[model samples]
Target: MKKLYSLFIALAGILCFTSCGDDYAYTAPEALDVTKADLYFKAPGGTGSIEVKTDRELQATSSVDWCSVSVSGGVVTAKVVKNESIESRAGTITLNDGVLTSLVAVYQEGFAFGIDASNLKTLNANAADSTSVIVTSSSPYIVNIPSYAASWLSYTADEDGKVTFHFTKNESGAPRGANVTISCDDREKSFTIRQYDINSFVGAWKVSYADGEDLYEEDITITSPSTGALYLNFAPLTPTVTPIFHCTYVNGGLKMANGNAQGRYSSYYLFTLFSSTDGYISWAATYTYSASPYIAEDGTFYMVFANDGSWPNKETNGVALGAFTSATATNAGFVGTLATYTDLVLYK
Candidate 1:
């Protein structure tokens, strides 16, 4: 009878345990949690992971095509693609478990493609004429000047940050240009070097004038010479030592007045005219050079002078006008052929 009573008690305990199933409860894992402290990626690109704890089923995605994302075994995985361009890029990685969400920034470095400025200068030929272009990256860089521009353009850098570029004056007739490049660090920058044309007629020369066989050979210093006009100073000083040649471009013709360039003094010659009946007469005469210094296409030059004013206009004063040229023509003598014996040539 006592054993039967014990069996009954054990059956009662089993029944109570079975009846408690209707009041049972369940618990979830946890809210979203991330293990990574940084969100950036490298250029070569690779797969990275984020340890996450969530209460419900979760999914992961990327805002940019450069980044891809997925989730497996309670962990969010992100894959960053390689950045092959010359520019840096950025994007975002997103995580959500239906309601709660999280975002992380993704970044990758590109090439070193920038400088402080886009334009480069020339006639930078001077120490005072240097251009400091700041480098935009930490990688090593190099400067390149074209072969044709080797004589003028160049580059110099003490270390990196700011580099100095130099250039020389252009001496060509037409405008000139070249390409200047900064290369290295997987990138480059291009700059154009443009320069103006050089002026002609800018030096000294010896000049020769003649009345007979071997006449006057003098050094004539030309100053401020240009296609427009020039100032001429004679070595063998004349009463009016300085003359101005007002030039015309069409045919390279020149004109000058009786006075000097500043018109301060007149170019006058004092002489005596011998007349058979009237005896000898003294006079001061002035001549104006017009269409004078005509430079021919073949490089030959010519000049002629006419009387501007005279004290006595007599037949003996026929030496008023004179003409000269660089041709092989012989001098016509001071008293023959209205054209006096004259020659003008470059002395040197």
Candidate 2:
């Protein structure tokens, strides 16, 4: 029995050693070359493959296995099992069974101009990485700011990365400066304003006889007599006035002089004046005229003077001559010819 036990023990030991040898754990193949290992995709439930080459032939019992593959945060990763084959195979073989990972980066495009409250345009953004758009103005506008206040305006950005701004005008109702601001990405850009002139106030004008019997009967174009000089010629049949006839602009109001005879002479003279607000002018004058009087459509002045010595003796009613039909002043002064009439000489 002891000898039989000994033999059994030996057999068991030998069998254990043989099984251990045959069941050796697989190790990743060394010196294996990755010739064409890259990302590849297949249909669902289909096997994906990664090709690799080896320096030697792999045993038939060995096999290659892919452990895992993944892509995240713009990066790709792959875990592969080295050669499972006992005998190495040369050239390239396909690797399958693990996920393949790859990475892609995110891109953005944006722009902005102007202010937060009265923004001209809001910020803009796009995913295409590049884009462009046009802006248009809706009105001819005037922005006013007090001289005492800070002239700079404010602006802000929109969600899409666009910005807008507004400008203030000066006391003269003109834009202060040409500078406009564009705010974007915590930065600013400036543009200039287009300026315009107030040249509409300078031009030419005329006067004609209106009222009973004289309605449109006498048409006169007071021609330019000299620099800042005007001439009025009466029709051959029209009545004449005294020798003194003066022409001047009062407070920007165009006026003509009317002279007095004998007891009728008063400190104030009637003036034929032109209105500044509207084109309508009338006859009015205080004995002592105001300086630089701002003329209005309702304001008046007259052409006061005696008609003749014979008519002067009688208690004659003063007449209100017609308003100024036209009056023109220029930087170079008045232009044209003076008219000639008896009894009335031109007054400065």
Candidate 3:
């Protein structure tokens, strides 16, 4: 009976020792190593994921689901998920089982005008990105004066912020300078009076003829009607010899000259002033004459002569007769050379 009692005591002591050991024994959870942490997108909109790592094995049961995450008022709350492999993901994601959370900023594409031409006749705007913005005009707008494609009228913001626009008269017979309003992204701006004047119409012009085989060396001067009367002299060197006249504003058309002159009478003279946006003029003229004659109506003697002839043939002949003998005349034709002129001076 004593031995039995001793055995029970030993068993009880061993049980107490085992219970103490069990109370003291414990394994700490592994700490997650978040080597890299950042919000993928700095600008607004889109999801951001957090990455984390650990040296020891992680339990799936302790991991949190990512779909349950939520972000509000610019604050992001994510559920931690155990992903062993380092990789990118979408939506709100937490790293290392709730150790770290990253929130992506939400943003909408924005546009701005680096230069504002609202007060002027033209409007210019710069884009922040490759984004495109719809542009509308409040008052009637005319694009591409002189031409559409060659004119700088509209612009798309390519990655770089460079853009240009040109504005002018919209309706036919519109005022020289008219006001216009430009709008973009619900923003509106106004431009003052605009003009499509000869200043913008005039360009480097060359005169060519014979199907462009021959080109004349000359320049053209465009004088505004407001300044004074306008005239185009064919040969400025000899203004009187060959001059072309035109009205300052002749029914919006250029006045032209046409006439006939006698030969020798080198009607070589062709002075016609015409209008041309293409920078060209066509001038022409004609000449004619009658032949000398020898005739008699009352059977009186008469003679025909060419060149200069002298009657009463004396070295210093002076004669007086009761009647006359003959008389004559002739005809001829003449042509002139083409010439050109301009307002711009060119170096030889």
TM-score winner among the candidates?
1
lDDT of 3 by residue, 1-348 (tens): 011000001112222235645643344343444443333321122343333354333222212243334433223343433222223234423322354322222111223322333333221122111112233322222222122222223333333332344342333221122223344334455442222322321223222122123334544333344442443322353433443333232222222222222112122433322212244222222211111212232221111111112112211111000111111121122122233322211111
* Residue pairs that clash (backbone atoms under 3 angstroms), model 3: 44-105, 44-106, 44-107, 45-105, 45-106, 45-107, 178-194, 219-342, 220-342, 292-329
Tell me which of candidates 1 and 2 scores higher on lDDT. Answer: 1
- Model 1 pairs whose backbones collide: 125-167
- Error (Å) of candidate 1 at residue 94 is 4.1
> Residue-wise lDDT of candidate 1 within 283-315, one digit each (tens)?
122432333333233223233322223334532
Off by over 4 Å in 3: 1-94, 98-118, 122-211, 219-348
Q: How would you encode candidate 2's per-residue C-alpha lDDT over 126-230 as one tens digit per residue?
A: 111111222221111223222322343333434444433333332332212223444333344444322211211112222233332333433333444544433
**lDDT of model 2 at position 327:** 35
Question: What order do you get sorting by TM-score, best first?
Answer: 1, 3, 2
TM-score for each predicted model, relative to the true structure: 0.31, 0.19, 0.25
RMSD for all candidates, in order, please.
22.9, 28.0, 28.1
Overall local distance difference test of candidate 2:
0.27
- Choose 1 or 3, whichever is better by TM-score: 1
Query: For this target, which candidate reaches the highest lDDT against the unseen true structure?
Result: 1
Worst 10 residues of 2 by lDDT: 1-10
